[model samples]
Target: MVIFGCVGIIAGCGSLGLWLANRIRRRPVELREFLMALSLLDTEIVWGATPLPEAFGILKERTDAPWQGFFADLQDRLQRGESASIAWNDVSLAQNSHFCLKHEDWQVIRDVSKGLGRSDRQEQHKQLELIQRQLALIKDQAGIWSEKQAKMWSYLGFLCGIAGVLILI
Candidate 1:
């Protein structure tokens, strides 16, 4: 029973590490998909010549989960006559416990929201393009962190677990 308990502890620790690493990996993918959705919105604005509220209403293809909820909330807020910035702020996906976004990610979204639909078409395009560039850079950084740190976190957890078991024994 003692040996089995120790083995369970080790396995649990290792699995916990892997789970955390998965969370780390997930952030970038989510952010990238979010960016793609934003780009689609940008296309609607620039090419389709749609207004902000209508553009949001027209977007049916959400690439991920919370984003659909986020946008739905946003549209609802807009329908209530709240400004774009307020609506975006109100529909914060970052506040979700299951979401893997960092403060930086939240900052990016917040910054993007602040000017959304407030500027002229040309200026909006420029602003969104800049946001896209920033998001791409952050996504790259997250990819690197996932690649390098995830293994480290898993290995370190396993080693730490083993060390703890040995010490206990």
Candidate 2:
């Protein structure tokens, strides 16, 4: 029973560490997805000349979860007669908890909502391009940080588990 309990403790700690590491790794992937979705939105707005609600509907259909939800909510808000800027800002804030992005990423997103749908296609395109660039930089940094810290977090948890077992024994 004693040995089993120690093993359970070690396993639990190791699992927790792995989960945290997985979260770190997911951030870059999520950011990349967001970047792709933004590119799609740009295409819709620039070339297709789609309206905001229609573009958001397309995004809601094409994107994965979290992003899909974000666009869906934005589309719904727009359909309900809310201003584009308000819809974007409200959706971004309301769905903020669902995303794995960092503070800087959120800041760029917030900036995006500020000018959305308030300007001509040229201005919107420039704004979206700028946000995409910022997000790409953040994604690269997150990828590097995840590669370094994920292993450290996993090892730290296992080491702590081992220390606990040693002390108890």
Q: Write the per-residue lDDT of candidate 2 for residues 1-169, one digit (tens) a residue.
A: 9999999889888888888888888899999999999999999999999999999999999999989999999999999999998888888889989887787788888888866899988899999999999999999999999989899889878888888899999
Residue 126, candidate 1: alpha-carbon lDDT: 84
lDDT, candidate 1, 41-157, per-residue tens? 889888989877777775544556767666766777888899998778767853455578898888887777867879877788888889999999999999888878878888877
TM-score of each: 0.90, 0.96
What do the candidate models score in CA lDDT, each in turn? 0.81, 0.90
Measured by TM-score, the strongest candidate is 2
lDDT measured at residue 137 in model 1 versus the true structure, 0 to 100: 96
For candidate 1, what is the lDDT?
0.81
Evaluated with lDDT, which candidate comes out highest? 2
Give candidate 1's root-mean-square deviation (CA, Å): 1.8
Summed over model 1, clashes come to 0
Off by over 4 Å in 1: 58-60, 93-96
